[model samples]
Target: MPYVVTRSCCADASCVLACPVNCIHPAPGEPGFGTAEMLYVDPRTCVDCGACTTACPVDALKPHTKLGEGELPFLELNAGYYRRNPHADRTPMYVVPRRRSVPEGELSVAVVGAGPAGMFAADELLRHPGVSVTVHDRLPTPYGLARAGVAPDHQDTKQVTRLFGAIESQPGFRYRLGVEVGTDLTHADLLAEHHAVLYAVGAATDRRLGIEGEDLRGSVSATDFVGWYNGHPDRAHDDHPLDTERAVVIGNGNVALDVARILTADPGTLARTDISDRALAALRAGRVREVVLLGRRGPAQAAFTVPELLALSALKDVDVLVEGWPDGLDPDTSEKTRLLADLAARTPAGGRRRIVLRFLTSPVRLTGDTSVRALEITPTELYEDEDGTVRARPTGGDTQTLETGLVLRSVGYRARPVPGLPFDEASATVPHEHGRVGPGVYVAGWIKRGPTGFIGTNKTCAQETVASLLDDFAAGRLTGPARVVRTRTQALDLDAWRAIDRAERAAGEAQGRPRVKFTDAESLLGAARAARTART
Candidate 1:
């Protein structure tokens, strides 16, 4: 049987390079590679060599025969790509690029984030001889979003951190966790000791609804909700209201679906995962029974990816329903449309909890005296732009009110302005040319690209940034001392972070969980300090 790419594919494209048959569609330079939801395998060309299985960090590749009932859709999804976009030439194998060599002297670089992008950039730089990397993050723990942003139930996706752990183990890799770039160490401070500084800080803020009553007590951003449940230090103490029978999410992207799924998921199932204690406890006691995901656009233009939709559809003991589905939406329009049509056609299983996918609805205003009581929304009409982009325009008729205690704004994420770097406010990103901001200054990941693409997407993004930095270094454009730099901030080193990691894992093992996280900075720091004291 041919190997099939499953839902967990991270789009890192490692399997594309490993495949001897060169069957994977949308390789790095190929069309649609950048925007592809997940990499698909061309079943006709796959040789069943099993190389991709080993190359995939998340184990997303599996034989077609071994697919479970829920995973059988991916086989067609993989084969369907070829039906739509067939490759005429498949003879040439993908060649690995030659490793570039740097100057003879030691090259010290500082990466100003511990996210996937920063880690990937550091890994790429360390490929050259005489190069050293010091990663700095404001948080005490490393793996920014990979540790805190990913949904707790999706542990397979989190496995990418193991690959990051290997990168951390590489010689010359160093960490200065809990040190903020602009506050703790100035950009000039980093440049003074390192040959170049690469900023991979991700998008930190969520886009606002800009509607009236948005500041109501029960209203919150999905970003905070995700972080709260995932144990992000910034949102660990956040208390989201869950006393209502229904909660409404304002967007239909994967994050929206994630929040909806988590809200309606079985608390017992979440207990086995690494969800924060506070969130788990709240969920167990909460009365939320239904989550309504509101999409401004129709099913054809829904923002949630197919993989995420499939996962949400497969939720055990959860009834997935579609509301406000347009009258003439053709099920044959796309895979997403087809899946949504199937969902709309399903008979309600009378599951314990429910998730409603409501389309073509735009929130007009939040209604309440002190807290959110109802959401007023208007129907939208879809139209295609000159650039072939689908957009929704509100129709000023028959506005409906949804009664709910909680409202989550899940429009999207925006990159915050870095203190010392130039930023583009309109785009919410750092202005750059091929990841180059200025001489010896560079950027990578969401901060550079404006919060787009998947976790593995950062691999290629970091590679491009590192390439530009290396080019500048090779041409004598970069100027900095090779000496070590010291900071007064009491940052957590690699050993300190490892100590906290061990403590979390040991605690989780006792409770039959993956890892029980320390939700707050105080607890994390205490754990690290306790570990150090024990060693002493």
Candidate 2:
């Protein structure tokens, strides 16, 4: 009856930190833990305390008896991580790295957007012992993308926020959720109050394919799709566009794999994870099977991490196909290459869910009338430069058509500028060095740097930002914003957060489930406000 790892797990390894007996594998900070799909509960060692369940934001963990029928496969997936080595104790939860310290009254700072970058920056800054931090966000819930943007099956990744939650409850840090700085308050106001403001707003939108049939009913940006399924208040109420039999994803990155895995996963399997009820219902009725993922370059040039490729290829019933490996490169048996080759080798001998990995091919057009009915593509050629970088160009008169109903654009994410700050549209980042963008302005996260790197990469980045901020504090450079603090929320708050958490758990209990999330913001905020009044 051990709960299994479903398709949506992003290996953040939070459960490893929460588990009392340390039953979870690839613990946080472990080598492979960062890339793992989800944390697994060791059935033999699990005392079934359910501590991990409460700690999970996406609700990926469950008691063995609590797993729904479709999630039964995960039990095996969780157990499989230990197959090769019985004593592989990687992924241990490590200590927070050395924290930066500053003078008492000089330690005040304002950080916009409660996403991973903001949270990590705050976590690093709190090490100063006396610094007080005010974290601002547009949504009622904290832990920005960690709670809203990550895929639903990545419950363990979401669990990292339990650490954030613990941080939220910390004495010096103040989370002002549902407050947008530019709107509710201004940069001037924050500067008046604190020494500096760090904008960690993240890359909130998707890069368009900019081709035909992009706005069609079936086509969806994996960004929007992931947001909708993971209960982003903005998209939670909107109808999902993923009603199709065949899906074409135009990138080979991790996000593309997430969409492909979700599209090909068993609806029953998804129901067990924290996938939105609306998405689950749509999936139950949708026609998606084969998702053809297109890559503009060859395997070596791929932007996706080696592990994500393996995770996508390793699904039970789904088969992954790689069209071309680099011409002269001898394939190594490294886990990623081996898994990728296995994916290529397992493609149905010719038929499966058909995650066709096409290299050096660019989308010429998406052919369809009312909605997408097919796609037009042109074959591309690649040449290596003296720098060893491969470049791709289309071959003339080599156009082909692939009949499909859905197209997903999974190019990289572009970080957005904080509304009031100076933005370099080309870079989408607030210009900064060592965290100081201006006299009282600074930035962090995807907005500070374009969307790149893994979660751990942010720590060093955040540390660097804090170091610069501290240096400015020592120099008496950063000033406070213009306005005074006005504490009024436009929407959700902590009491409301409690109510939302309660409602989700209550729903899970009513249906003999673990915990079910509220898909829309209205319900969450409404419940949150009600809870606030009740507490008062």
Instruction: After superposing candidate 1 on the true structure, give the runs of residues whose Cα lies further than 4 Å from its correct spot.
Output: 103-105, 482-484, 530-536
**Distance from true location, Cα of 175 in model 2, Å:** 2.0
User: In TM-score terms, which candidate is top?
Assistant: 1
- In the range 1-536, model 2's lDDT, one tens digit per residue, is 45444544444444556667777776654556544534566666677677777655446566767765655556765675666436445343545545555656557888887888898888777878778888888887777777776666655566666667776776677767778777778776777788778888889887877887677665777788778777677887667545566788898888887887888888888888777788788888887777888887776667675546645655667767778675665455343555566566662744555677777788877766667778888777788788988887776856889888777788878776576777888876778877668766777778888887656445557877888877777687866444567745564555566677788778878865546776656676776777878977
Global lDDT of each candidate: 0.89, 0.71
* Candidate 2 lDDT score at position 103: 57
Cα lDDT over the full model 1: 0.89
Compared with the true structure, what per-residue lDDT tens digits does model 1 show for residues 87-173?
877874677675886554467788999999999999998888779899999999999899999899989889989999999998889
> How close is every model to the real structure, measured as TM-score?
0.97, 0.79
TM-score of 2: 0.79
